[model samples]
Target: MISPVIPEDSRFESDPDEVLGDNHGLPAGWEVVPPDPADRFTVARLTHLLRAHERQGRGWAGSGVDDVLVEVSEHGLRTRENVVVRDPEGEIRAWGSVHDRSVGRMLFVHIVERGLDDDVAARCSDVLVEWAVGQAQAVGAARGLETQQIDTGAFQDDERQHAWLAGAGFERVRTWWQMTRPVTPEEAALAESPDHWEKDGVVFRLVRRSGSGLPDEDDLREVHEVLEGAFVDHFNSSEETFEEFLHRLREDPGHRWDHWWLAELTDGDAPQPVGALIGTVSESSSGPDGSYVSYLGVLEAARGRGVAKGLLATIISDAATRGRDRVGLEVDADSPTGAAGLYTSMGWTTKYVTESWHRDVRVSPA
Candidate 1:
């Protein structure tokens, strides 16, 4: 690894235990540097570097760079939290970030140039994992959480990245299917049959809006509550604060209050939220193109009541009414709830598959 300099303003320095390369495995004139805060330079650099790899049919179709940058600007992300590894010619070769999702939980994102040789990519990935584990450990310590899981993923077909993650001691825990359904205004406008997409004791509709046409905060809070309760038994789920949940969604430029929806179970004397679905506008290289299902959940007590199906129907119909080209969602392949099968029966097809790998990190008191 080349000797590299850390700018004075770096947010978090590499911890000694992490044994992070001083220069982050930079080779020759290469450098690992924090993102530039004042401009789109960081996001643009990341997008460019990864876009080349994706063209080779391995990487994910991430939320477009535009919407991602919106998260950095409106959410809690800071430029220094993610770094770019650039070659001498000023072209980025890799990018990495650690999102501290919650106490004892972290999400690691690492992407390297798909064109790189196995040895080169391995070196880059190792250095980044060192830093990511260090970052997660620090956050865990601060939160009084000594043990945490830092996770990363790769396309199932990308054996090279899999080898790298396996080398880092992460075990493959699960897989996911990223699915999408094509929609036309005409198809979406199809008349709904009462028995279709609905169960006898469930009522589903779009989230309510107040007089000013803004979604009522009460309804928004209800969505969060339902999601938290519904995902309790889901694979690798943890509670997210209401504030974080709300602001995180708002960070997406495609987030519109109108796209939030709800499902209520009415079997009891009173009706209460048993399911919820939140969607965001989707864009293509050309421009605005479709809608994406960011979150959908049905409480365990309400599962068989068709709350999930009803919520999905509302989204599909709404996306059609809005002239969206398609609807997309992600499901865990190993979910006990069989969420992937549900999406499949609803006409969504798997567009791609990814593997999830996770490493447990132990932190001592700082």
Candidate 2:
């Protein structure tokens, strides 16, 4: 099958000033190469190459490369790179790229180069930091930079990435724990709620895409509210518009309507869904069995009475029925409710840990 067509806005473009200029005072043989639309074959080759690096336990992977390329090409993003080093043959040895984001007038260093060797990787990382500082300066001059954010989750496994961030003058702002649970025949059987847990005033039901039909505007609005309210106090809590949330998920390679759920209290004259769990199956490198569980939330008022557990159990059963091998989710490491404990009790294991890093950017003087 042909690869999904990514719009022009998502691909990278060559920027002469940023790519050719001195990268934060480092001596350079670097050049920023745009994601040439005509270079589709090269991009695919790079994707496979990056995945190979990931399998060999390299710090970088290809999880979001497609999305990045698409954004650079079709989204009108001003992506820039600092070429810090080059081989004698002029091949790129070390470099980094910076792109803009929707929140917090910030620019993200999406890709950072660590040389092929460990010593070279360290040396290249140091130069990448300087380049990042320069990018911050440039962004501040142009758009009044608020903060510089780089997610090492895409590359670093755990504290290793954190150490690099700290060494680069970044601070750990948050922690995300990736959790996964195997879907077994037992889980499908266990999903049946006990009579005592069942309530006269409320009921739990599974919403299948085929059975219920496509989710309408009302369904999307309700789920949007559920997630907005659920994560209001969590780390990096920000209200995302309905359009933004839908757009982002729709862009995912694994998104499907069947993997979503909505819950409601049955006692009311007109019951509305008060909780939801939206998920997608990923056949990507990190997810082979098509992992699920993208976003799950329960309204504050709907807490207790087995709502959360019931929703989770229902989704797990759904995954099993659909022939999924495992379900995955990322939970805040410091949840006040100890959600990680809940997931653990339900059989999810800590597969890996990730850290979020942030650098406060000084806006250039007007």
Query: Best candidate per lDDT, number?
Result: 1
Please provide, for model 2 over 138-181, each residue's C-alpha lDDT reduced to its tens digit, 9 standing for 90 to 100. 55555444543443343345444456678877776677787888
Off by over 4 Å in 2: 1-28, 52-102, 105-160, 190-214, 284-288
Residue pairs that clash (backbone atoms under 3 angstroms), model 1: none
lDDT string for model 1 (1-366, tens) is 112222233223433333465656556887776565456776776666666655554545554576446534423453126666677887767777766565467778788887687777777787778778777767677667778788778778877777788888999999998899988777664426221244586777667777777677778889999999988777888878776577557766788877787888776788788888999888777754788999998888776777777777777787777767789999888887778788889899988887889999898678
- Model 1 CA deviation exceeding 4 Å by range: 1-25, 57-63, 67-75, 78-80, 189-199
> What is the lDDT, from 0 to 100, of the residue 347 in candidate 2?
93
TM-score of every model?
A: 0.86, 0.75
Q: Least accurate stretch of 10 residues (summed lDDT) in model 1? A: 1-10
